[model samples]
Each structure stands twice: as structure tokens, then as C-alpha cells.
Target: MNTSVVDCQKRLCPLRYLPRQPLSDPQASSQSASCVATSACESSALSFKRQAVRRSITPEFAKKVQSRSQVPVSRRSMRLQAIRPLRSLLHSKTTVSSALRPWGARGFASALVDKQVEGERITKVAELASEQAVRVTFEDGATAKFHKLWLRDHCRCEHCMHPETQQRQLDTASIPMDTPLHRLEVTDAGDAVAIDWDAPVRGTPCTASEFDAQWLRDHAYALEGGNAEDEDTAPYPKSYRQPRLTTQQLWAGADFQLPTHDYNKCVDNIEPLMRDLYTYGLVRVSDTPNSMEATEKFSKKIGFVLRTIYGTMWTTNPTNDAEGYNDTASTNLELLHHTDGTYIRDPPGLQIFNCAAQAGEGGESRYVDSFHVVETLRKENPEAFRVLSTTPLPYFTVDNDAHLATMEPLIRVDYAGNVVQFRHNDYDRAPLTHLSFEEVGEFYKVHRKLLEVLRRPETEFCMRLQVGDMMIVDNQRVMHGRHAFQGGDRALIGCYIGRTEYESRLRVLGII
Candidate 1:
């Protein structure tokens, strides 16, 4: 009930007008006069009025009125006020607890983390070159010296890179024994290095890291002034731009094989070979029997092995599947410089191809190192690179009706916006949805640029395989294509390996 209405009822009662106290202290005067008046009124005819009013106010209604008076001090309001500071304190406590955990205990958080902390931290071998090695101080205050030989061996020079090939041209013997390293100096730029060494006893500068003729003159000990600009010493991009496996590092074998002559011994080589593929995107096996059926058997073996881990074979079985309408597998010379399965979420981890025959003709297989292409694109066309890197192209999949398709972007990024993988296939491009026509045109333009880079003769490397030349690669990083074959009826067998087994096999061999 409204307080005004309650006051009106009180006034109407016979006891209401009896109190008369106008005093300096309002609280004391109202209490005393109201009490005396209440007693006098109860004693007289007003007693009937008091009893009626009391009877009208039910216990539940009185309780509700009392509850309304205590609204500001309710349990929910009190509880929320009580918990506000505590919630903040609890969050702070959790943050501190996580920070206190041991370095080794962090979860699979990142590969970069594992590589830096676990592998590079402890195993960064010391260097004793003429130049000063950069000292890597661990969290515990201990430091390790990294040498120029180590730098030279693991040079990221182009000559060492396998743009389209995975051959290790660095024979330790190739490093001159007589060459004396004077000192080692590392520049902050792109981790570049400058080394001063004694004159080569034989075969150019021995123990040189990415020895371009121009680089040699720039840092050469005996450079004549006039000979610097000579055509022979013309400035060229460093050969060390190529990627290479670190010297003396033995990788565990899982799938790929090096030059093992014995068949039984090849079993042990699998993990390292697989690790090489994981790290470098490619690996090779030599001296298998030369036959198309043999190649198929090799491919099938890889498939069967992969299925054990992946749980299902995801090969595009063109012969049996009606869904694979656009699945074209031909012996025809198509330079398919394209990635496989951009339509799927996680594409194939590894691709295994076995060469049936190499008739010594022009049907040599070509591989484009997409990773190297990415590096090149970054260097040459930074603006175009930024556009391609920022924009997303819809990677797609379709049913028999090309109209019915699902699409995702060709480039996938993490929450922090790091480019994780690139998935693109011309075959599975779905129609643009949110993007404008102009944006789509820009996408195609950049895409075509990427394709052109892939097809460049300098960018791609070709290898003619003899019978029994089987290769496995990280499918996401490498793109394979073939040349026009003059000889009749040549075929290669292929299969895919998923990443789970590919990695587990590496761990089993202790390579990772």
C-alpha cells in the first residue's frame, strides 16, 4: 500500500488527531506524543478504529512492506559487492601461478618455442672461428658460443637452397682444410655474416658461407681495386639464400631415405628422411627397382602406412569416386604448379611419388619451392607481397554441380595473424561471396603473379628420375609439375601421408 494512503487511514481513525507536540527536537517530541496519544486513543472510542486498521493489515502484506523497506540491503546486492574485489584478486592469483610454472612444463604452445628453448638453447654448439661468435645467454645465465663454421654449414644461401631440389651439395671435404678463419662478424640484418679467412689453398674460398663472387670481393682479403667491377666479379645475390640441413645433425628416419644401398638398412633410415621432409619439405630415395608397377607398390605401401595413423585414406580416387568429377590425372605434359586439396581444411601432410622410368627424355619432373617463392616475393615485390599476404582468397570444394560449393580462404592465420599455411587450387575456386568484383580481380592478379614466380626457370629446379627414384615431400610447401614427354606412355605413382604418423615416426627415431 502507498504510504500516503496509509497516513490517510491513520488520520481518519479516532486516535489520529490526538497527538499535539511542536518541539525543538522532532524525534523526541513525535515519539512521546504518539505514545501517549496511542494509549489514550486505545482506551476510548478510538480503540474500535485501532482494531479495524490492525485487522486490515494482513501478516503477509506487512512482511512485504518490511521487505520493501530493506531493499537497499538485500542479499543479492550485498553478495555482488562482496565478490567484486575477490574476483579481481582471483584473476591475479591465477596469472601469478601460471608464471611460476617450470619452463619445460608449458604445453605444445608453439614450435617456435620448442625450437628456441629446447633445441637451440642447449645444442647451439660453440664456435672457435677468427671472428667473435654471438653469445647466446640462457635464462639461467649460462652462455654458448656459436661458430662461423656452424654458420657456414647452415648457410641460408641460394646455392644451398633446394628451390625445387633437396640435394645437400655441401661435402665437409668441400670445405678447404687449409683455409684459416681470421674472425667471425654477424650483422643484425637478416642474420647476415661477414667472415675474414686466409686465402684459399684450392677451389675458391674454402669454408666460405654463401660465397658469391661479388660478396667475396666486398669482404675478400686480396681484392684489387679495378678487378672489383669486372664481369666475373659482378654483384650477384648470395647463393647462400638457399636452405640447407645443418652439418653433423642426424635426422631420425621415418619415410624418406638417403643413399642406403641395403634394403633392410633402409628401414632404419625412415624417421630421419621423414624429419628432413618435415623441416625442408622434401626427401629422396635412390636405387629402387625400375618398373611402373614397382612405383605403384611403393606408393601403395606409403598409403597403407599413412592410413594406419590417419584412420582413413583421403586420396582422390578418380577412377571410383563420382564426386571427383574434375579429378584429372593424365600423362599429358601439364605444368600443374598448383597445391593439392586447398578445398579441405587440413591438406595432405606428405606426397610420395615414385618414378617408373626416366627415358632420358624431356619429361623431367619439376618442383617449385613455394617457401622460397614466398621469400623471393617478399624481397622483390614488397607491396604486392603485402596485398597477397593481407587478402584472403576463397579455397573451395564442390559437388558435381559446380554451383554447389563451400569455400574458405587460401591463407589461414592464427589469432596473432601469422600466416600458417597457403592453400590454393584453381580447380576448386568458388564464386566470391562478400568480396566485390574489384577485390576479386585483384586476388586473381596476385594469384597469377604467384603462379608466374612458380614457373620461372630460375625459381624452379628440374630433376630427371631414373627407374626407382622415389621422393616424398611436405605437400603444403612444395609444388610438383612435369615437362612435355616425347616418348610414349610414361607414368608415375603417387600417394599421400598424413602429418600425425609423419611426426610420430620422427619422434620414435628421436629426430624431432
Candidate 2:
């Protein structure tokens, strides 16, 4: 090779620039020098092609580049001209350019190559065995097992899955119980796990499909006898194990306080507010602006204000609203422990009440976790719990134009029998149906028992909200009420927020 060619290759392969070892063996130096020359020639060729495809330097771009580098375009152009002959020499055989590339360029090239190599490795099967169930160990040391039924139902080929939606089309029920696997093999490059069926099962013919290595790894289950931490299982609820604090536990000392945050902090960083809500099912934000607009803005931080017959946001005080045939929330009477909007199908997930003005003596706010009460009732009085959980009660709201009503059990349970919500509004209780005379009588007895449980001294947590203090409660779990006030200026601005929206914000913040 020419002397210049060797230097060019050295420039490309900077790794060879490291100090050479003692040449006790002369052959090592020759071998190293030959390698450097070959690498430099290859890198030059690749760099030439890259430069050719790059956009032609406009005057503006050139000026910007020159300003940043403090270099003239002519000097840069002359350097490119010097490499043109070398580029032409190596272009026809493109292999040399990559080998001769500089460290940075080589690193980038290797990254792409690494990705392809990794994909190939993932599909390589390390082991395959089937006794009662089919198991596979991947080349990366990860292992997985699949039930025959599970594998048949999860086929992802175009024939088994809808190409557009990527949803499985296989009928789970139609899969035969005696389905047998003929053979299982790792595909070339280790991209997938391919399975072959021995014969037709049910009406479907023997078929084969490739399961992506990544997909298998994700869905794989840990071995049954493995350590608990190694098991792949759905995580427990974020709010699970939260203390079911009693009224005494909550207000234990004079310095006792609700989980509180500043209004601005609540808006700017929602994690604290969400954390409070998840733990206590309620949070108090202080120093909020004493205006209905501020309440609306605060509610909007969680989600949009939920509009109802009273509109998106409303004000309630002794002087402004009428104490006629309407909701008790609008009146100044001592209200009972209950959740709001039981009459609506989808009750507000969250409720916000900003105390714009303080009252004279009595109007203290009260809260109780109905979920806690339900758990107690379930444990103490199983019969009463059954009645409340099974009997559907009617809740209705009759306003000037609205006659909304809905029927649901007092205690709502999810599919897994976990308590999800509680609906109890004595003032809004409508006529009961879908029950016999004896059942109706029993329901009333259970209902009274439930109310007694909620009204327990240990269950009620009270606080007198001051001006600029706002309370945010989870309507699903926490029931709130208020005491009667006599002679002071007591005003509250309030709004509702949907639970879905509140959760969406938490998800966006990655709090849940």
C-alpha cells in the first residue's frame, strides 16, 4: 500500500493510534500496520458516500456553520477536495470505508449492528421441553412456558389475527382439549419461537406460527416454585394498605392537621395532592383565592368541572340561596353523613369546597370513609352487609327541570368483590322497588344499621374550615356533611370533578 494510504487508514482507525507494543516479534508490527491501512481505506470510502448524500451547503447554512466554528468555507472545501481522490479509490469497494472510520463514526455504525445482532440472539432458543406443559428457554437465559390453550388462542399470524386491528380471531372455546405440539424450534437469527402442530385439532388444520421473542419474554410467567419476588404478577393497588384511620387517630393532637398543600403547589405539582387523596381520601389546600373562579381553576387542575343542574360551579351561603324544596347542601341545616349526587348515574369522582368566608360558631365540616365503615359492617354484621350489598335503593333529585334518578346498591363492589364505592344520601332517598315486603323491611333495618355505623364517634373526623381553606374529597369513598351555623358570614364555593379525569391527571404525572 502507498504511504498516504497507510496514514489515511490510521486517521480512520484511531484505535490503532495507541502506543505499539515492543516489537520483539517483528511480524506483529507488520500485521498491525496492514490492519491500520485496510481500516483507513474502508472508512474513507464510507465517509465519501455520506458526504455526497448530505444536503448541498446553502449560503445561510454555511454562514451559520462558519459563525459557530470560526472557520472559512474555502478552507473546509479545500479539505474535502483533498479527500476526493481517496474517496473515489475506495467507493467501488465500499467494504474498506467502515473499517477505517474514526471512533465516533465506528461507534455509531456498531450501535446499529448491535441492534441487529441482539434481535438475532433473542430468537435463538436455548432449550425446549414439554411434559405437562410446553416450556422454552431463550438464548438470553430468559425462560417461559405456555399452556396449549393459551398458545392456540394467542396466535398472532394474519390468518389467526385481524391484520388491521391486530386482534386475535381464534375462538378460544373452539380450541380442542387434546391439542398436541409436534415440535418447537428457535427460528434463524433467534427472532421468534416457531411451533409445529402434529395434526389437525378440532376443525382447524395443523399450523405453525412464529411468536416474537420479545412478546414471549414480556408475557412469560415465573416458575411456580421460584421466590416470591421473582414471580411476575400484577402489582397490588397503589392505595392498598393505606391506614383506615379513625377520627381519634386523625385528630390526635392540638397540632393535628389534614393533609394540606398550598393552592399554587396543588396546581403546579399534583403529586402531593394526589398522594394525600390516595392515602386519606381527602386533602385540604390552604391560601386559595377567596373566589368561585379560584375554585373552578383548582378543580380544573385535576380535571374539568363536572356540570350538573347547579352548573359547573356554584356558591352556597345562608343569605344567597333559598332554603326551599331543593338539595340540603344549598341550605344551612345540619346535614347527615352522605355522599353527593347519588341520583346521577356517574356521580362526581371528586368534590371541591372552598371556604370563602368563615361562619360564626357551629358550621364544622365532617368526613367519614364509608369504605372503612363498610369493611367494619362486613366483618361485624354479615347479614346487614349482605342486605346493603344486595338491595338496590332509589335515589332521586327533583329540581325545576331535572328529575334525575338512579338505583344501585348502597355498597358497590367490583368484579373481584372489592369495595369500590358507597352511595348513601338520606335526603335523596326515593321509593324502593324490586323487593318483597319482608325484604323492604329488612332493607330499612340494614340501612339504619349502616347509618349507625357511619355515625359512630370513632368514624367521624371533623374540622372547621377557615377562609381561604379548600377541601378536596374523593366522592366515591368519603362522605361529608356539615353542622348548622347561626350568625356569622359563612360562604362556600364548590365544584365537582369526574373521577376518570382525576385519575387521568395522576397517570399523566405518573403518580399511580
**Candidate 2 accuracy as lDDT:** 0.61
Query: Candidate 2, which segments miss by more than 4 Å at Cα?
Result: 1-223, 228-257, 319-325
* Lowest lDDT block of 10, candidate 2: 107-116
TM-score of 2: 0.61
Deviation of model 1 at 505, angstroms: 2.8
For model 2 the local lDDT of residue 35 reads: 55
**TM match of model 1 to true structure:** 0.44
The Cα RMSD of model 2 versus the native structure comes to 17.5
Q: Write the per-residue lDDT of candidate 1 for residues 228-332, one digit (tens) a residue.
A: 344232122222111122222222223223432322234323334544555666667776655545544544333333432223332222232443434443434
lDDT (CA) for every model shown?
0.43, 0.61
Each model's TM-score, in the order given? 0.44, 0.61
Best by lDDT: 2
Instruction: Please give the RMSD to the true structure for each candidate, in Å.
Output: 32.9, 17.5
Residue 428 of candidate 1: its Cα lDDT?
60
